[model samples]
Target: MSNQTSYDVVVVGAGNAALCAAISACEEGAKVLVLEKGPEHKRGGNSFFTDGAIRVAYHNLKDIRKVVPDLTDEDAAAVVMPDYHEDDYYEDIMRVTKGESQPELAKQLVNRSFETLVWMKGHGVKFELNYENQSYEKDGKRQFWGGLPVKTENKGIGLMEQLFTRAQELGIDIWYEAAAVELMKKEENICGVAVEQDGKRMTVETTGVILACGSLEANKTFRSEQLGDEWEAAIVRGTEYNTGDGISMATAIGAEKFGEYSGCHSIGTDYNAPKVGDFNKPGDIYKKHSYPLSIMLNKDGKRFVDEGADFRNYTYAKYGREILKQPDHVAYQIYDSQVRPLLRKEYDLEEATYYKGESLLELVNQLPVDKQQFLKTIEEYNDAVQGGEYNPTEKDGKKTTGLTPEKTNWALKIENGPFYAYPVTCGITFSFGGLHVNSSGEVLKKDNKPLSGLFAAGEMVGGIFYHNYPGGSGLMSGAVYGKLAGSAAARYVLGNKKDTKITN
Candidate 1:
């Protein structure tokens, strides 16, 4: 711990959002300090474990080239990366949330997404096309699906390292293993945070505070209370340090709660995945998104949800919750040689939890399910599959005809020899509940009044996500709100009445 007792802005957490805030505050001429709950190796909350794909509104190839200038003419010709307009972005949010997301917050997220990506680029953050996760090539053309097209270079861990390096270059001090325990409030005004580091505790005074520590995904108690009892057995897909410290601390100090407390960004992960994410491997490998291209069977060998109801990006987050409702919270994604090549890169990892068999019956024999029931289920599904042109890039509507839970798209038969099945369990990413904040990123009270000296961003700022989330939007939301919060906090500390926007 430093002898220094104060800074102009104090940022809790050291992930993408906290780094963005710290960088923004420092750029605005404020002395900023970042407190990370984990050690140096495990610093970047959930953001570290992600692929760092950002879904931003872009008009054309020219707009994308601005962020990734290295994009060559050949590259543009090889891929079908369509322009995602602002309205399209907004509609995705509203449609996914069923109009439950706050309008103002959604507008801010959509409108400011591109600008935030540009800002990060100008600040030395590199971006590249997410070839592995976002697109699948067919007929000599790479067609991108899911509206998300770009990702940080080297993915999440790379993004965090770049941000941390930039913060250090700008003289922003970061204290690793410094877990913030409480928010220090002076009457109704926030002032500083009390953090514990190296078995010692100290209070660091600050003119403004930014809470970007993350959610309660790793906290079993919080999950049991808010999500459901079934979530107690869910695996954590991110950092173990995000146990709702920021949310709890702010809520204790009059911060209003908002959004779907019962909702979260969960996904189907390898059943044998460790309780916490492995820093060495990151998190993408633990994910089993290939279910979209397979037939997901419960323990009874009965199909539950429609595996191809939508694009994998659109439905993957919510399917984990559905998996939790299954018997023993277990599900198996069955596929054959015909569909094997269509599986995502994550499914091919050496550490992936899967089994291979020469036939469907052979595969079910390996799985913990009734062999007859499993065979019957596959026979019925195979019979229902209608012959259609198989297209992975778009919704081809190649579907099943008369199944109770129809595969609405990407329907492929499992008749090919050498079948594969992956056992999966639910893995909670982050909760969609936390402190409420305005467009300017000022934390609001239960009465809708702004809390002085306090602001929030990232997963800790609610109202943007509800029942489900769009893929790649999480990182964009964090950056957008983090910049706004940092600039707002800096203005408050500088005694500036006018709100200034932070831009490159």
Candidate 2:
């Protein structure tokens, strides 16, 4: 290893957010060093496991072309893309979080999403329309629903590969297996980081430190203590390395804790998924997000939640907690042959745990739930399904009536033969609670003052999410704040040396 022990900025973690910070700092002529807790094989954090769908506001096809320049006339003609304004993005965040999101941070995330994406494209990160996950063929035209449509070309793996390539080309030093054990300080101003690398402790001096090392979802003890005992059973859906290193190190130094401690981004994943995320089958393969088109039944064979209460993007994060609350923490997503074609690709994976039968009665009998109650529940659900033009691309008000929990949208009858049931349990993505930060991405002290030389990005910086989150917003917010923190940290180091004005 090189004997270099000083850098203008030291960024913890090598995920999308952390790499973005490193790249942004380098752009400002700052010598940046990146520390990854995982080995080289497991470099990226949760970002490598994501589907890479990033939500951004765009005016029309023209705006999308700014990032997806390969969209030809033929490609544009084949899809009907809707414009997602900043107001729409902001409203979705506030609506999903029940207005618990910090106003300043929420506004920054929404307004800067598009520009940050464009900046990412400039940094060699590829972009493409998320047709497989966000689009549906309706009226011979692929209509992209859910204000999110863009993703990295090959999802999370592609995203990280490109970022790492760019970082290497820029000559940024990255130390893998170097865990930041402590944040070194000098009279209350962050000065360096104490890292454990190759089982040897070392101090890396720096003018600023950016914490992008993720949150506490993978730590079972932290999950049980913060999210309640029921959450101890929640399957971690991302990197095992994100065991709250950033939160613990920052909090120990008087960084004010913020956001919903009891809340997290959880979802219904395959019942047989590993206790922690599997890098071998990454990119959200274990998650079953098509529940908006299926009826979720519990162990008692009763519908506990309105599966179609809203779009899956708005409700999927919170539904896992509801599943965990069920007896045995197990639920089944039931779908008929008519809607089977609408299910996401995760349902067909080899690792998926599901049962199929020619009819609803046969399928219910094969499931582990109460067979009699399961049939009765399906009968009641079928009887209540109202008649309307069923549209999977949008919320078609074809709802059910007279049910304890009504399916408010896409309420299709489970009458077609070849019924299927997939057993699922709660899969926790990340915790919502983290260090508080301002618009500039500076971590704040307990007194609400900016903590000098310390900044945060990605899941480490919280308050933009609360009880629930809009799908794709997590990555978008990470990029947005990561850029902000990197630029701010670089400016902090540069001081009066050069004009370090950042522009989109």
Candidate 3:
């Protein structure tokens, strides 16, 4: 640990958002310190478990080249990229959240997304086309969909590695196993942080504090109380260390709680996945995101949701809640040989929990669902599938005729042999409820006033998300607000140097 006990800014958490804040503060000539709740081995928080896909608005390949500068002429020519303007990005957030997203925060997130990625690129983060997850091969060209095309080179692990490298290069100090337990306040203005380091209590004096330590998805008590008792059974898909430390500490000091407390970013993950995220196997391997092309049957052997209501990017987050409400808190994604080639790579993992059979009868027998009802469900679904050009790149109108919860698009019949069924359960990624923040990322009090010396970013800053979220917008929001918080915190600290006093 560093012998110095004073800093201009102290950032809680070591994930992408916290690191961005640290680096940005350092660039503004502030001495910054970062605190990681977990040990050195488990550093990146939830960000390490992501696929690193970031959503941003861009016109075409030329705009993409601004972030991914190494794209060759041949590589660029092979893919058909579409234009996604700021209005489209803004609309997607509103559409997904059902217009519950705070307008100011949503606008800042959409407008600053591309420029934030560019700023991150200058700080040593790398980017490339997310072809594997966001594109489909059509007419001898890779056509990108979902308004998301860029990802970190090696996914979340690579993203954190680059951010850590840049933080080190900028002379930012990070102490692992240092968890912030309390926010030190001087009257109404913030002064320092009380941290638990190596099982010992210590105080770090700072003028500004950024709480980017994440929310309460990992805390079972919080989940049960806030999101309901059913959420207690939800598997955690990310770091176990983020157990509402930021929320509790901030709220204790009068931070206003905001956003949808009942909603979170949950998804169908492998049923056999560990109760908590495993560092040994990270990068979204537990997710089964290709359900849009398959029918998900509950234990009652019935379709619970319209599997193809929209693109997987739009529906995956909210579908997990429906799976949790099923009989056994489990659902099976059934697919046939015709669409076998379209499943994502996560389906083929050696650890995946799936059953394969040569025929429909044989497949239903292997599952715990009602065998008779399962077969009948498939029979009805097959008879309703309308014939059309099965296009995976766009919302093809091929749908079922009169199904109960109709498959609105990409409805393929389950008539071919060599079928597969994968068991999945709800895996909660992060909570949407958290501290309220303004467009400048300042944490607000109950009176809608900014808390002095306190700012927030990442999942801890709420109001940008609600019932559901767009595919790659979480990381983008973190970067945008993290940069804003860091810059604003630095200016706040420097401008108040006359009144700020550092004590060892």
- Give me the candidate number with maximum TM-score: 3
Task: Order candidates by TM-score, high to low.
Answer: 3, 2, 1
lDDT sort, best first: 3, 2, 1
Which regions in candidate 2 have their CA more than 4 angstroms from the true location?
496-504
Model 2 poorest ten-residue lDDT run = 495-504
Q: Over the stretch 1-504, how does candidate 3's per-residue lDDT look in tens digits?
A: 798999999999988899988888888888999999899999998999999999998877899999999998898999899899999999999999999999999999999999999999999999999988999998898999999999998899999999999999988999989989999889999989998987799999997999998889999999999999999899999999989999999999999999998899999999999999899898889899999999999988899999999998999989999999998799999999999888888888898889999999999999999999999999999999999988889999899999899998999999888999999999999999989999999999989999999999999988989999999999998889999999999999987884545431
The segments of candidate 3 whose C-alpha lies over 4 angstroms from its true place after superposition are: 498-504
CA RMSD, predictions in order: 3.0, 2.8, 1.7
Write one digit per residue (lDDT tens) for candidate 2, span 24-75. 9999889999999988998899999899999999999899989999999899
Best of the candidates, lDDT: 3
lDDT (Cα) of model 1: 0.90
| Comparison by lDDT, 2 against 3, better one | 3
Clashes of 1: 0
lDDT of 1 by residue, 1-504 (tens): 456878989999998999999899888889899999999999888999998888899998789889998989998889888889999999999999999999999999999999999999989999998888888877797888789989999889889989988998998988989988999888878878898988998889886999999999899999899988989999999999989998899889889998889999999999998889889989567899878889999889899999988888789989999998899988999988988887888887888989889977777888888778889999999999999898878888999999998999999888998999899999999999988999989999989999999999999889999989889889999999999999999989876323323331
